[model samples]
Target: MAKQVCMGAMMQCSMGMAPSSLVPTPKTVMTSGVMAANIMDNIPIMNIPPFGMCQSPSNPVVAAATAAALGVLTPMPCVPATPAPWAPGAATVLVCGMPALNDSSKLTCIWGGSISINFAGQVTHDIP
Candidate 1:
């Protein structure tokens, strides 16, 4: 990954290097209603191209076992959206942080969580 220093925020990765080819090439940006159109056109199976997640494992075997266990076990606290006293159905809502950028030319990064409660008027669970 190649990074560029722009107006201070360590902007994002400018161009990604191919493992097979060590070419430092320029990336093209398209304004045709798609964010990663140019990058996706050249790469196959590149849904949401040029973006990926890198998981750093503190302990590989432990992490894998924990994930496998979580897949089979049920969640301890399942909080559905509880409705107000007057409302009939439960109303689920999420609160999200502001996006990093509003322009089409820039990337937007947002983070947030969901609000969950039980009908028994207890704030049971939250994960963000």
Candidate 2:
């Protein structure tokens, strides 16, 4: 059995500008045999969050290259959006599950990785 791993972060919006929109995009880079069962299990309910939006591209070549490197079955594209008002309170996001070799197998080695959110324009968040 694979032990469940959960990671969470509280991101406070301080864009310094009123009425700004934000689209949270989650990116994951993992070793082969790992699958993402639910990307929204721990994520907060925001106006809009781009989940699995790194597969499509304006150029087919770029998309193909990205797909091959990421080992994704289907490519999902990230769409651009205008910034909206910054809601009060901290925005919470979480990623769950450890990389598993298979349904009945789990990797013993510690997997090293990180998650990041790409925002438009100048913006800062209190995340560590």
Candidate 3:
């Protein structure tokens, strides 16, 4: 009797498809998977911080190849008599295509490499 009823239902379903169960569907599953992937892709971009703004100077500060040299090379508010690990102010660095330093320049430490200022001084940067 049960088999007969199932066969009858199958025949009816073949003629006109029965309604799907009111539960999980393929669209819901695919949407969830895509949403999960999208969330993961966004995480890394959010973790990135703005250029030249690190928690400490020890961290790398990635910036454009060309920017205001003073802001990119040194800390704000000029301090005299201090030699930066990489470059120092009042020391000649190529500014606006000519070697110059204004009163606004200050001691600054770059992550790596050294710079020598002619008729001035030299700065060495030691990177770990």
Candidate 4:
């Protein structure tokens, strides 16, 4: 059904308008095609790219824009701010000595948003 995640994997955010791609460094393991990623690949711009625009009110930019628009929900450019790793990762499957990133993995955005994996980077020829 699902499989491991790799670099350039498509990702989305709950408070984001469009999807973005994952940018991992291939810590522990890497697939034949694209380098596999782990939970440690949760960096801000280095690993996670922007998701079009952000719609969360908690974000300062969005908040300011909404305020300027007279209480209207005005979205702003997305700037991912994840300070931790993907939760509930494959603990048993270590990548770069850390938990391997799974397709169902979820990353949190500090601006009140949840990032999710839309599709793994690899098309075929993967371990699982």
Candidate 5:
């Protein structure tokens, strides 16, 4: 079973240089002092904060910077471009009428980065 994702959960992006913490909204019931999360909780900077620097060539900022640097790879500040919600969340669990976010769930950035949970924030809450 995967642990339910909650506020302060740690996440890392494939093209990111550092990990960022998940900031779930307060629209759902509390899991363990902090609010639990759902698939739709992914709202870019509001929920999913930046993951340090981004190295994806698909990102316009990085691409432009790299091109300006004479083909040298230039990493820009990571501003996660999550256009959609996390996938493969807890299908058996519901939060705010949506699939509850689980530790094993994955979120994709528009810049071709795979975001994954490094820590689920709490150990007691598990979901199928």
Candidate 6:
């Protein structure tokens, strides 16, 4: 039988290289349909490009695992309404942060246009 590893235990463990532990504390925010991107709450400000714009993990391994474990934890790619507009619909946006304690009250959007996108999944800070 395959050994089962509990994500909670790993996260809580004192392991040095644990990817999950590297994630910063997440915060919840409400969308106001504003043009400015809502900065991720309680995370280190590291400009890592694309992912940095959304305050996601700069490490590829951590990023992939985080995305798999916590669905919609990263910004998604979207076709812009124009060729190169800085508007919300014109590009990908990070409307959600790392899930915590089975809650995702932080999920939000800033897309200001007639276009709409749908994402479905549960949030969990636990990573396996």
Best by TM-score: 5
Which lDDT tens digits does candidate 6 get at residues 1-128? Answer: 11111111112111111112112222243222211122222222121011122223543444575588775445333211212211222122343432222111221212221211111121236568
Model 1, C-alpha of 117: deviation from truth (Å): 34
TM-score on alpha carbons, each prediction? 0.14, 0.16, 0.14, 0.91, 0.93, 0.14
Candidates 5 and 6 compared by lDDT, better number:
5
Clashing pairs in 3: none
The CA lDDT at 37 in model 1 is 19
lDDT of 2 by residue, 1-128 (tens): 22222122212222111122322233362222222222332232342333223333433543576678795544444322323222121223223332211112111101111122222222235678
Instruction: Give each prediction's root-mean-square deviation over alpha carbons.
Output: 19.9, 17.1, 33.2, 2.7, 3.6, 17.5
Off by over 4 Å in 4: 26-28, 125-128
State which candidate, 3 or 4, has the greater lDDT.
4
Q: How many steric overlaps are in each model, in order?
A: 0, 5, 0, 2, 0, 1
Residue 76's C-alpha lDDT in candidate 6? 34
lDDT by residue (43-126, candidate 5, tens digit) is: 999999999999999999999999999999999999888988899899788998999999999999999999999999985656
Candidate 3 lDDT over residue span 1-128, tens digit each: 00100000111111111211111111211221221011111111121111222222232332222134643543322111113221122243332232232222222223321112111111235788
Pairs that clash in candidate 4: 28-96, 30-36
Candidate 5 clashing pairs, residues 3+ apart or interchain: none
Worst 10 residues of 4 by lDDT: 25-34
For candidate 6, the lDDT comes to 0.24
**Tens-digit per-residue lDDT, 27-66, candidate 4:** 5467756688888888898899899999999999999999
- Model 6 alpha-carbon drift over 4 Å, by segment: 1-101, 112-128
Error of 1 at 83 (Å): 26
Q: Which candidate wins on lDDT? A: 5
Model 3 bad stretches (over 4 Å)? 1-34, 37-52, 62-128
